[model samples]
Target: MLHTNHAKHRMPVVTAVRLAAMYEDDRMLRSIRDLAPRPEEPLSVGEVIAQTPIGTKVPVTLFPTVGINRPGTDRWPVLIQGLEEIAHWVRTQAVPRLITGTEPPEPGLPMRYEISVGHEDERQAMSAGSTTSAGERHKKALAAASARGDLAEMISMIDGSPSEPQIARWLAQLNHEEVLERMSPLRMAFDYDPEVERHNFEVLKGCRDAALRFGDSDGPHEK
Candidate 1:
């Protein structure tokens, strides 16, 4: 009777061991490409074997466990290197495959579905809001630069070094105190969004004011 009960306990233990082994195998077989490689070392053996096939996220998970597998060649292989290398190999191989009548792989369904469902109005609103926020930040940055007598640096940071022609035009606009009119020509000429043009004009005007304040040196110029 003791032996009979002992057999029953042994059976469950055996089953549990088998299940644990199977789970370990599955874990070992998973694709680790997306997982960051351990720092301070080249690729590891586990990573080499855990690579997925080209153009697919599905893991290969099985290899001969011996011999070198040169990637992107007619030879035994289990995996390759980084995604960029894989992409390059695919592009290199694609033309020949297409010439022989193989269809190119399309993007996965989820990406296509997301693109199809994109909300244009929401995107436009988001872009507009971002532009507005950037403009406000630019003005504040320009003011700070002006106070420090470094308007040129702020102007360069805003966009880039303005051309001589551009500086002359901005100077005329600033002298006329016509910031809105300046924005119109700059927007059209530079192909900038209206908000960006307005922001740039304000930055220019701030620089001119800063220059005048520095030149006067008698006192702050009357507004």
Candidate 2:
């Protein structure tokens, strides 16, 4: 399903601008001690990092609003490049986790969810439905509806019920994931990241094999 939740809770415009400003102006990052919510109180660099929308998938337009205040005509590209550098740093350095004091879940715990990409609405559902049966049901319903509409459209074209272009324009006006969604008249039926998951699985398997070979001594470590 498409994930749309992020659209509603987008990072605030001011926060995006400030973070973009920090990236565009080295002096701002260097003089981080001066950042504050008000005139008298000083905010630490870590605090700023916590407040910044590190993981937010905000719109690109926010960058231009921040860049217009700066000196050069080339500010947009420079800001983009700088933001990329910062994102790289955030991922590798684990800066977001450090500042937020959040940690990865214990590997022993059951796999709660899997990462998949979809449209905005689907994304929203995935986030809200995490580890919940009801969420899964909703997802399936949406998928089934979408499939039905697709099958219906294909059948209509094959049967010569209407011109393809006419059907397409009608479908567009319905403005839904599947024409059935808004029209309600149609009916129908219908990688894992190997580098990370596969690598982890292999390591675990190797450890298990070695523990079995060593018996009691190495078995405890496997646990």
On TM-score, the leading prediction is: 2
What lDDT does each candidate get?
0.37, 0.37
Q: Write the per-residue lDDT of candidate 2 for residues 1-223, one digit (tens) a residue.
A: 1113552244541122334322323222324354432221222355533233668653322112232112222232233334444444444345446755776322212213454645557545544543333334455566655744553355343422343344333444433344333333332221246565545444334433332343433223312
Cand. 2 Cα-lDDT: 0.37
Stretches of candidate 1 above 4 Å error? 1-191, 218-223
TM-score of 1: 0.17
How far out, in Å, is residue 195 in model 1? 1.4
Measured by C-alpha RMSD in angstroms, how accurate is candidate 2? Answer: 24.7
The TM-score that candidate 2 achieves is: 0.18
| Tens-digit lDDT string for candidate 1 (25-68) | 33443343533432222234445433445885652322122222
- The C-alpha stretches of model 2 lying farther than 4 A from their native spots are 1-95, 102-153, 156-160, 173-176, 179-223
